[model samples]
Target: MCRVPPLSPRTSPTISWKNCINESDPPNLQCGSIQVPVDYGKPHCEHFNLTFARIKTNGISCLGSLVYNPGGPGGAGSDVVFAHVLKGISVWSAELLAQYDLIGLDPRGTGLSNPMKCDPTIWNQRVSMTPQNEEEFNQLVENNKAFSESCRNLTGPIFDFMDTASAAKDMDMVRRALQEDKLNFLGQSYDSQLGSRYAGLFPQNIGRMVLDGITDVSLPGTAQLLIKSNTYESTLNEFFKWCNTTIQCALINQDAPGIFDKLIGTANTNPIPAPGCSPLSEHPCRSDATSEEILTEVQLGLIGFNGTVSFTGWPALSLGILEASKGNATLLSRPIITTPTSSDFSFLGVACFDCKATSISHIDLLLKRQMTSTLSPHTLGATQTYQAQAQCTGWAAPATNTNHALKPKKIAQLPELLLVNSLWDPSTSIVWANLLREQLLSARLVLRKGAGHTSYFAAGETSRAMDGFLLRGELPEQGTTFKS
Candidate 1:
């Protein structure tokens, strides 16, 4: 159970704001910023700025501003909406651009909202963990240690305070600033957790809400990490299935398993060049084929709200892989960054602050216990283990009461919530969507049978269903799963 910490003693309910309207910025969509208290409990204290953008509805019957968040924990929703989603919406694209205000805010410590900037060089450097020997493995540990230290040293108390719960409070502040009675949440991936938390915190204020590619906040740390590890295995298997069919993939290796082995083997022994020959040196290329680099690239390709967004960038990926197998490291220089964007990282600080911050000692003990058990051999020393361990060790956050992290007792009282999942989503799985549905009890599910993280935007029945749900508060029939 997640317990709410004593609200920061330094927050103001009334948000202050600063606006910059360059009438000449091509007017793609209206954008602005809001200054919210860095701490929510103290209504009359110090404040931090958060940026927000709104795309008003056109002629269609306005159903209140959809306060959309495209889950990053670190991913920028405002940037995504302005650059992609809202930009693609037909009604909002032309006439309704002015009518419907599509709100995008860089939650605290993200984007321009009291942004957290780490040393770019230190933050972007990535060292592969697929070590050639024990020495290399030790080096991998050092790399991780250094990376964690770098983040801690560079970022300040702001980094320590960024968490989803606080961000939810910021969302509420956004609603008030826009003068909306309630919020229509369009949240994906990690953002789903945010949306669910918001609903749990303030069910009465929920307008139409859709949570895509759900995250199960109810799961204990060990179980949640297990699910994430298992997801990687499943998604990689699925990726190989696709790779095996393509002539390029087939020529490389006829079988799915062998393709993986060959890719890993070649990358381990040699440096592959980046894929494209662009003048820019940082772009993906063939010459950068370190097994670690290849693995990172492929993982990024395979994982998302739905597995397909990576596909959009696959040609470059394939080219990079092909070049690497042939021995070129120059082409893959660009993908080596270790730190995630603001979207990829949410409030690790706040997560720790909300629930007691995790510790490496606990993680080490859990990993040791798991290793001694009969759990999958692959489960012992994995990415999720390292991720959780690092955060616990790196962040010196005080834990909030455990109850602060727990889900509420009643979900049926809220509006009919739609839970979207991709059959092949790698980050948050169909299993997670199921878990979320079970928790909400009254919520409906829409399964997109395609590649991607969240399938709402992907082509197929899922897309159609999402369109229907958003346009009209209709939920897909239970047990109805759509294939890509």
Candidate 2:
């Protein structure tokens, strides 16, 4: 059994919880900030405020705080709580709504916390994450290095410490500040890694933890990339399946797959013109749509499905593909890039700091591209892994936490964990859920066989099962499956 480490005495600056309730804020919402050490190795050296929002239950009985982290490593938990939970409280079960106070904390260096900033121009550059040749690859490396240096110069030494381990410790601090002996957490996507690390570090303090859209930290960079690419390819295949069967799809019975392939070929040789895009626009609305841009849009559209009865952007994607096939790129180039915010920097900073990158040699890059193409020939291996590799090629900061290699050592005293994953999830793969389950011996796996990213928010059976477990300590039988 792995022994949980004892928490150090509270040497960080004290934080006071203030009631910042406003008309726009969620009902029964209380907003506040807590001070935590920037570097846990030196708790008293320097501190920053971690902002949080809580929606206290109005029921007669209270069952402590349920802290939530909505992935992104850069995602603002407070924003999720306000926008999703509080706004859609009716979707939740009465038992869950009555019991736990939903708390969302913006991890250090994100959102209302001491957010790190960098030059927006660096991000605005129209560089392809998937470089086609050596020259483009070298340019990507230089651009990535410049971006990292900009972050280091702007954020200083603090940039080196925004790893997941630091965020996990900040979670513990939030628990202590809320005067709770145990923490109940719901972490999605990359935040699942955060929650898993927290559970490994402080098993004794865990109450009820649910990790949805499971991320397997055990996989090597290359393996991770391959798995993600293959999974995305599967999702694309699923989309094709839908297009062939469903009348709603504009490309139904039109050789959708062949059309998509020809569209990519055309964009590669001659970039399609997008008259709808404007140079003066704040968005990344380009005047032309490259093959890479169309691929990215399709990938994003597939990932954004809500697991509802109908897919969200399938029609749009079908129309976009049809339009691109006809030489009109107007729909395909509709501002894929949103305005860059602090979260953009935080995402890159935290991700690069948490995971060690493989060597960026030309041979290695070529091998990776070859592997990705082989595994996912249709998609051409374009996934988040490629993006991470491109951005972190010359990352300036060394990793503060090497906890990504943590295996699930049997800890008998740990609380039961609930893991959820959508079978066709575009971002996090179902294989990751299985890998994580193997490590977490006490965990119950809920497989939602449907489309979408995370399962809980869609108010499906997965959400019901999660609510049952979180509120009433009701664990579904091991290996249970739910249909979304």
Candidate 3:
């Protein structure tokens, strides 16, 4: 613990430091909390206390705090410190760790911060996300609205302000509270959503920022969903190609997509059974899987391999497909658990606030279903983009952070940033990365011609590029496309 970080100044004079809430928190870490307005517009009405964990550099050299966001709009950095960082399992390298204070943030509606809440009883009800008819559509909307009401009744007004924009504004408060002139940041997946909003709000305070797994939030909701659905369909073909060539694949020498399509047809006519399997087991194995659940599971598996995060490899995915084909969906159905609160509602809560879905009637939904399914037959629009929009159908909170083009004037003085993304990222499509490049005019993109959610998750040439840039103010020249 020699040369550990000093006790940092509080985020506010009134705020104070304390031991981390979790018992296994890192030894040399200091945890604290600060109260930000529940609604930025109504700063004085009420507030939410946000908590954070920090670990200082071991070296005498310092480059301010490296603010990290683990992406899920719901991902809590403080939890990450105890769960992953302290265990030597993280994306941050030793060199960057030596010179920066690591700030572990719990966003307003997540982590140890006053979290979003919904009645487990209400949440447990299962209504089809893809309603088949007008009656089913009304049921889905009713359930979603009831779920939203439960969250609002328990989480209060802070529920409405849980969007990425508010979190971005809250990020600036942490920056100023730490007394850093610039906010050095590492944001992955959905974190880019927050980072872009921050850049649009406070460009002059920009520091060396790296946005990995780049998800562009500026696109219209329908466009975003279709783009992601197309990417997933493409990536699924890549997985099928691997199955055809690799001996490890259970479906080797067999027509994988044909078999998959057949399984979907069977599932539609008669749901596949998972004998003696629990729906929400330790690994989330489930029983009676639907065609929709199968695609969702495939989407999770296609997050790819060899990153800091664990993803189901192609071999495992093939085996799962084989299992489901044999009428045993034990391996194919997961994360589509029976209960809603049992799943990560925070992802939906943050997504609903961010998407601000309007009350479209059954007619509009029927068209969306037809359009997306035709656009992506194999995957059937099983992207988070579609899921988020569908889930927010009847949210009660007003949409405060609606999608729009990024303000170029706000980003004019912004420092150059390194935007890293996977060409075949199942979650964040490469198309969005291109659009984001155009949005952040000064930012340079280094496209990794590989598969995975984020490049920085694994320490390769791409991660090293991000590392060098964040540790120092290094970025490639404009129009220089880097591939690894």
Top candidate when judged by TM-score against the true structure: 3
Better of 2 and 3 by TM-score: 3
Taking all chains together, each candidate's TM-score versus the true structure is 0.79, 0.91, 0.91
Error of 3 at 315 (Å): 3.0
lDDT of 2 by residue, 339-452 (tens): 334576888888888777775666677788789888788788777667676678878776656556544452456789999998998789999999888777788888988876
Which residue pairs in candidate 3 have backbone atoms (N, alpha carbon, C) closer than 3 angstroms, thus clashing? none
Better of 2 and 3 by lDDT: 2
lDDT of 1 by residue, 74-163 (tens): 666666655544345422233223334567666777766766654445434454433334555455456545644555566654665577
Q: Cα lDDT for residue 1, model 1?
A: 33
Q: What overall lDDT, based on C-alpha atoms, would model 2 receive against the true structure? A: 0.78
lDDT per model vs. reference? 0.59, 0.78, 0.77
Worst 10 contiguous positions by lDDT, candidate 3? 1-10
List model 3 lDDT by residue over 216-276, tens digit each.
Answer: 8776777877888888888888778877787988999999999999998898767799774
